[model samples]
Target: MGAYMSEKKYTKDHEWVSIENEIATIGISNHAQESLGDIVFIELPSVGNSVKAKDEICVVESVKAASDIYAPIDGEIIEVNNNLENDAAIINQDAENDGWIFKMKISDSNQYSDLMSEDEYKQFLEQ
Candidate 1:
């Protein structure tokens, strides 16, 4: 796997996920941000909200358009990055890391293994 994508899994919807302990950190992939252009605002979910896999968990608005960010797996949101409220451009600056949208207490760890690996995600994007 590429160095940056080492622990990250990509979704067809342009989201990326990385699990540490039982917490799954979720964010949009770099490709998603590039497509969205300059980000302006974000609507994050409440910290204690429970979400199912594929649920729309957040909305990211950018200069070009607004896009919905979905949950990659079933989980309860444990925390959200409030930093984005003041400066949403952080996503444009770093989509995969510092721009992470939320972290959740995973309900099913096995669901993570089903996401695309970096290489697979690259191929998916090419299709």
Candidate 2:
């Protein structure tokens, strides 16, 4: 594979986004899953659904509560992680990687730059 395509960016709400070839992969952060605890269900967005940045994209339910996942950039949903349908705990195990929730072909790549960097996210959490 080519060198890593993009740095992951984060939302204040704990979603993370990474873009490659115009497609943005989105997932909740580890802190989010840990806080939610033992995710039990996920309602994924449909492929082809168009969304604006900050729009509610899906829902995740844990033993503790249900959390909303938001779109980090304007886009049309292109794919979702089907594994989550049967096993929502995948997110608890790897919120940033194998547990990615959806992929969307972004409407504006520039929006990626506006999100927090990993360092900024960590500092935000510390605060």
Candidate 3:
């Protein structure tokens, strides 16, 4: 839908991460939100929590389904997108930008290498 999202890394599970300034912004992909439909609630992790790669950190519930938002890397949770609690549709409206699920201080940037790049993720979808 809408050509999917651009310029973001992806996971086999369909999570996406955008890296900037050693901080990672994470969310589900556009295709994910389109498929989930009419998001109604989000459950985020508390601040100051430590998260490991692939950890289940959030739960996003939509009219069609509820899914876990996994951690793409090991890191401590510096900030959760509090805005989502009040406006979960922000995620459906702008999954990559204002709707990002969380911002984290990465524990090892090198670990990011294990994730799929935008191009790689695109290929994953083609499969």
Off by over 4 Å in 2: 1-4
Per-residue lDDT over 2-119 for candidate 2, one digit per residue giving the tens place of the 0 to 100 score: 6466999999999999888888899999999999999999999999999999899799999999899999989999999999999999999999999999999998887899999999
Q: Total clashing residue pairs per candidate? A: 0, 0, 0
- Error of model 2, residue 14, in angstroms: 0.2
lDDT, candidate 1, 28-110, per-residue tens: 99999999999999999899999999999889999888899999999999999999999999999999989999999999978
How close is each model in CA RMSD to the real structure? 3.7, 1.5, 5.6
10 residues in a row with least lDDT, candidate 3: 1-10
| Whole-model lDDT values for every prediction | 0.92, 0.93, 0.85
Which runs of model 1 end up more than 4 angstroms from their true locations?
1-6
Whose TM-score is higher: candidate 1's or candidate 3's? Answer: 1
Candidate No. with top lDDT? 2
**TM-score for all models, in order of appearance:** 0.94, 0.96, 0.89
Task: Give the top-scoring candidate (TM-score).
Answer: 2
Backbone clashes counted, model 2: 0
Ranking by TM-score: 2, 1, 3
Residue 71, candidate 3: C-alpha displacement in angstroms: 0.7
